[model samples]
Target: MEYAIALVVLAAVVLVIVVRPLLGSAGEADRTAELRAELEAAKEAKYREIRDAELDFRTGKLSQEDFRRTDRELRTQAIEILRRLDELD
Candidate 1:
């Protein structure tokens, strides 16, 4: 009887050990999806910022050189983030 109980206990432990990682993978998927969403949002925000800067330039709020510099920098950063997001998927 004691051996049977020990065997059952051992099985339960082993079962838990094996199943824990499988359950944890669901959380990993959720985290990946969340990261992807954030990356997309950031990319969109960068685009919007670039658009706003262009509008500012057109309205004479920003100088030509400043607009070009700001647009270039923002585009580079957006490209890098997009590459990273592509890698994750």
Candidate 2:
């Protein structure tokens, strides 16, 4: 009877060790989805900002140099956001 109990305990421990990682992976999936959504939203916002900056430059509101600098920065940031989204996918 004591040996049986020991065997059962060992089985339970093994089961937990195996199953815990599967459960942990599910949680990670949820977090990944949430973060991907956030990144996509940020990317859209950056694109919009870039468009607005372009309009401002065209309307003589921003100097050519300032516009180019801001647009380049926005493009770089947008690319990084997209890369992150791709990684999640």
Candidate 3:
């Protein structure tokens, strides 16, 4: 009976060792997914800002120089976000 109990305890330990990583990976996957979603949202928001900036320029709300600078900055940010998203894949 003592031997049986020891065997059962060993099995439980082994099972935990194996299953713990699987559980941790599930959490990692969730975090990765959340990060991806956040990145995508940021990318879209950047695009919208670019569009809005263009509109403002056309409507004369922003000076040409201001628009160009804003456009360059927004594009750079969008590129970085895209790069991060690609890295996730």
Candidate with the greatest lDDT versus the true structure: 3
- Model 1: ten consecutive residues of lowest lDDT: 80-89
Model 3 lDDT tens row, 1-89: 99999999999999999999999999999999999999999999999999999999999999999999999999999999999999999
Candidate 3, lDDT over the whole model: 0.99
lDDT of 1 by residue, 57-77 (tens): 999999999999998999999
Better candidate by TM-score, 1 or 3: 3
| Stretches of candidate 1 exceeding 4 Å from the true structure | none
Q: Any runs in candidate 2 off by more than 4 Å, and if so which?
A: none
Q: In what order do the candidates fall by lDDT, top score first?
A: 3, 2, 1
lDDT for residue 41 in candidate 3, whole number 0-100: 98
- TM-score of each candidate structure, all chains considered together: 0.90, 0.83, 0.94
The deviation in Å at residue 80 for candidate 3 is 0.5
Give the alpha carbon lDDT tens digit for every residue of 8-69 in model 2. Answer: 99999999999999999999999998998899889999999999999999999999999999
Any idea what lDDT model 2 has?
A: 0.95
The clash count of every prediction, one per candidate, is 0, 0, 0
Query: Would you give me the overall lDDT of model 1?
Result: 0.94
